[model samples]
Target: MKYSELHGNIDRGFNVFLLILVSSIVFLLLNIFFYKFQDNISYFE
Candidate 1:
């Protein structure tokens, strides 16, 4: 019983870590793209 509980906890933690990594990467990429777009528009003004 104890072993199973430990295994479950490890799996949950790993999943949460992956979720965070993916979200961070997506957010950073979107931010970079938008920033470039903004710069281009401003330059044309």
Candidate 2:
């Protein structure tokens, strides 16, 4: 019983970690895309 409980906690932690990693990657990609778009608009002006 104790081992199962510990394993569950580890799984939960790993899931949270993965969520944060994915969100950060998405945020970075969004920022990069926006930056490039802004640069292109400014160049066209």
Task: List pairs with backbone clashes in candidate 2.
Answer: none
Q: What is the lDDT of residue 27 in candidate 1?
A: 100
Q: Candidate 2: where are CA atoms >4 Å away?
A: none
Model 1 residue 27 distance off true place after TM-score fit, in angstroms? 0.8
Instruction: Kindly list the per-residue Cα lDDT of model 1 for residues 1-45, writing each as its tens digit.
Output: 999999999999999999999999999999999999999999999
TM-scores of the models, in the order given:
0.84, 0.96
- For candidate 2, lDDT tens digit of each residue in 1-45? 999999999999999999999999999999999999999999999
Tell me the TM-score of model 2.
0.96
Counting clashing residue pairs in each candidate, in order, gives 0, 0
Q: In candidate 2, residue 45 scores what lDDT?
A: 100
What value does the lDDT take at residue 18 in candidate 1?
A: 100
